[model samples]
Structures are given as C-alpha cells and as structure tokens.
Target: MAKSPIVFAMANPNPEIRPEQCDGLAAVMATGRSDYPNQINNVLAFPGIFRGALDAHATDITEGMKLAAAIAIAESVSDADLKPEFVVPSVFDRTIVERVAPAVAAAAIKDGVIRKR
Candidate 1:
C-alpha cells in the first residue's frame, strides 16, 4: 500500500468512512496503537519533517524528504527506548523533533528534491 496521510486517518477510532471502503481497512486499524503495539501517527511524523525542510533552507517538501523524516523520527527511539505508552517519543520531546528535522532536510537536499536550497 502507498504510504501517506491516509495511513494516519485510517487508524482513528471512528474513521470517517463512507460506504465501499475496502478490505484492508481492518488490517490498517489493526496495526494502530489503539489496537496494536507500535501505533504511529502524522503527529509522530510531520513536525520534524517540516522543521527539517526549513532548517535546510528548502523551498518545498518531497516524498524522499518525507521518507527521510519518518526514518529519522524512528531512529531517535531505540528498542531500548520503547515502552507501553512510550513506543514513540512524546510530542513534547522537542529534542527529538529538533534533531530529526535537520536530518530530514539534509535528506531532501541529498535527494535533490529541493530547489534553490
């Protein structure tokens, strides 16, 4: 499946679903934190991503840049860093965000996804 914002919204408790959704909806929600172990969210992704793009002096974001942001965020927490209710870093973990964003921005530059950087 394609990775995008839809992944996050699908995990919502009351996903704003219309008729004819799909078969994979349950699978998606099953992998969510409310139901599964390593629950992920855009909140877990975006702040650091945009921060990174800005830090790199980039004019825009890109797919490679977003992938970099996600990986960067995941790397901040080790297996040793995980716990129930703490599998992902807290949103208030400014250090994690601050550190992660620049890495993502660097990825954007390295991927040549940003122009006039």
Candidate 2:
C-alpha cells in the first residue's frame, strides 16, 4: 500500500482537501489558508527574492536564482526540527530574509545575471 504522501492542496479561499479529512492518510498537508497548521504562503519567498534581486542589481530572475532561493528556504528548517506539520518555516521567522536574500544574491552573481554586486 502506498504510504501517506505529502499533500499541498493550496487553493485560495478553498483548499482541495481540508487537513482534517486527510486524518491518518496524509503524512503532511499544507494549504493556502492561514487557519491550517502548515500554511504555504508566498510571502515566505517573495520578500527575500526581491531583496536579493535589488541587492545584486539583477537584470532578471533566473532559474539558478530561483533554485538557490528554494534551497535557502529548505535549509531554514533544520532536520531535527522538520516535521510533517512544519515542513516550511513560519512566515514570521525573522531569519528567513537573512538566509534567503544572501543565497539568492549569491546565485544571481554566480549565474552572471547581476548587473552589479
């Protein structure tokens, strides 16, 4: 039998499936709504992404920059702290901007997309 799969049914105003319905079937669940435990919000990334772009004077956001931002976000959650209900860091986590911005900026510089460092 397939084990519980991580589900991210992030539909605005209404998620495809409520966290409660998953019960024991889902290993982890996320939604666009803040009422849920794991709320997958775009705010987590955009701030840092823009900050990095501005800091690096990026010409345009590239795939490498996006990947670096993703990696930074993933690294924000330590292995010991990772859990089904805590796959993503809190939206209010102060360190997110600190971590993601530099990572994205560095990636932009590395990918030769930055107009100025």
Candidate 3:
C-alpha cells in the first residue's frame, strides 16, 4: 500500500493521525494543534484578513480577496525556505500580518469591493 504524499489530519485538540505516526508515510503533514511542526491554524490568516478588509473598507470578502490572502501566505515562505515538513509558516511569525494584509487589501481594491482604497 502506497502512503499518501500529503496528510492534513487537522482535527481540533486531537488529530486523526499524530505526527509521529506519519514519520515515513507522508511527505507533508498538518494539524490544528500547534505542538506539531506545521499547524494549519486560522490564527495565521484571519487577523490579517480582517485588518486588510478594514484597511480597504471592503464591504465583503470576495473569492479574489481570499485567494490573494492565500497567495500572500504561500509567498511568505520563500522557495528556498519551503520544505515538505514546513509548508505553512509558524503562527507566531509576525510577517504573516504584514504580508497578508497588503495582499488582501490590494485584491479588494482590484476587485472593486474596496471603498477607501
């Protein structure tokens, strides 16, 4: 049986598969818990997203804005720094807000949903 290349067992307080269990089976793994290396926590994005919406005076968060936020988060991790075990940045990384806010705000403005630019 071939193991999965990626596994995002992002259960809340407990994940479906603990990180240790995925040692050689998965190339990448993520969980909702911060104890693991790659934690797929909303805390990494939401604050910046709200900040961007407020900054741009966006009436609503459109798909484009969401995509921009995702892109910003992805870009936050440089290609050279990107690793299978470190797909997403640490939630503690302060750069998330700096990167995501501008990207989301720009997307809102481009999408014509921003009132204040």
C-alpha lDDT score of every prediction, in listed order: 0.62, 0.90, 0.89
Give the range where candidate 1 is weakest over 10 consecutive residues by summed lDDT: 24-33
Question: How well does candidate 1 score on lDDT at residue 69?
Answer: 75
Residues 20-88 of candidate 3: C-alpha lDDT, one tens digit per residue: 888988889889987888889999889889999999999999899899989999889988999987899
lDDT of 2: 0.90
Each model's TM-score?
A: 0.60, 0.94, 0.91
Q: Which sections of candidate 3 miss by over 4 Å?
A: 1-4
User: Best to worst by TM-score, what's the order?
Assistant: 2, 3, 1
Q: Compared with the true structure, what per-residue lDDT tens digits does model 1 show for residues 20-75?
A: 25344433322333443445556767778877877777777787888877777767
CA RMSD, predictions in order:
7.2, 1.5, 1.7
Model 1 vs truth, CA RMSD: 7.2
Comparison by TM-score, 1 against 3, better one: 3
Pitting candidate 1 against candidate 2, the one with the higher TM-score is 2
